[model samples]
Target chain A: MPPADHSYLTKKVISIGIVSELTGLSERQIRYYEERKLIFPDRTGKGTRKYSFTDVETLVHIANQMEEGVQTTELRRELKRQKSQEEVKRNMLRGQINAQFHKRH
Target chain B: MPPADHSYLTKKVISIGIVSELTGLSERQIRYYEERKLIFPDRTGKGTRKYSFTDVETLVHIANQMEEGVQTTELRRELKRQKSQEEVKRNMLRGQINAQFHKRH
Candidate 1:
């Protein structure tokens, strides 16, 4: 099978109310997280916020982190760190795979 | 380089005071997080809590989340969800690699 279609996770199609219901966070709280730069939702011409599946997950994750007593700035830094670490790991894996593939040929 | 020796991340050798300083959380806050089941620190015979590098990271993550207004219970659930999701993704990637390797042979 082909790789899973993860586009839906990034497609900004869900509304803030739905995201709130799905994430168990109030709409106001979700907006606050956005204000804190923890999540970025898309905005329509009418200026309404639209979220994606990934955004919901992020909101949930952020909420979970906040519940643990993490400050927003620290959380932002941690998120950035994790993202970079994942990128590095992905690059290293890609290099290894390319090396192995070339060796077989 | 032999997988970069990530064992230090899991080795329980750091003290609570150090962890507090490293994560920018108070010793009492870290203990509170532990009480809320957000972190698990090893204990010495004298009842001192010894943390790993991973634990320090976790404490920082938890604190960051708490700062974003996530409740402890929600954070726990989100952490569990992320762990399982990562496991699933790893398994899928491993399976794909195995399949590709076998096909080449």
Candidate 2:
């Protein structure tokens, strides 16, 4: 991938204020989420926190989950679970594709 | 996202050999795809190319498209188009969510 394509969603271009406006979360709440390691934002040269579009989406998702009474710890665990599940699924698919390719050869 | 979680799909863990095995593409073919910028792999400290599972999947997808007579240039364009469309969709969703939140406030 080109540098631009690679950074498409991960680029830290949006400021915290913009992210707060986008997600409807206060700067404090956003920082709280970062403290919990729920969203990872990049620091600018002056140490300003800058977020990506992915981070904004995650913040919105986190807020929605919190509004539904889910605990931060539980949400963290759930995210880990989901990520691992995806990893497993991808591995299985890779295995299947490899198997089919070998059989065909 | 936690550091580990953020690097889950982006980490360069699998060697090129493993990636070739998983994707059923020869090392040469995999390198060819890389030449086309269809996938990006990271270099190890020893200068060995290391791929993530995401890169493996992308290689498989690219191989399938090639088998279907898709040109690399065309595939690149399609990927760019898809990414931009996804960006637009995400922005629209964010806007809707923001509007809803403000309305509720």
- Per-candidate TM-score against the hidden true structure: 0.42, 0.45
TM-score: which candidate is best?
2
Model 2 stretches with alpha carbons more than 4 Å out: A1-7, B1-105
Instruction: State the lDDT of candidate 1 residue by residue for A16-103, as single tens digits.
Output: 7657766899999999888888888877667878776678788889888889999899988987999899889989999999999999
Clashes of each: 16, 3
DockQ of each: 0.01, 0.02
Off by over 4 Å in 1: A1-6, B1-105
Whole-model lDDT per candidate? 0.79, 0.79
Among the candidates, what TM-score does chain A have in each?
0.74, 0.79
Candidate 2 TM-score to native: 0.45
Summing lDDT over every window of 10 consecutive residues in candidate 1 chain B, give the lowest-scoring window.
B1-10
Error of 1 at B58 (Å): 43
What does candidate 2's lDDT look like per residue over B1-105, in tens digits? 244635536655556765765678899998887898778787756787867656777888899999999999999998889999988998999999999999999
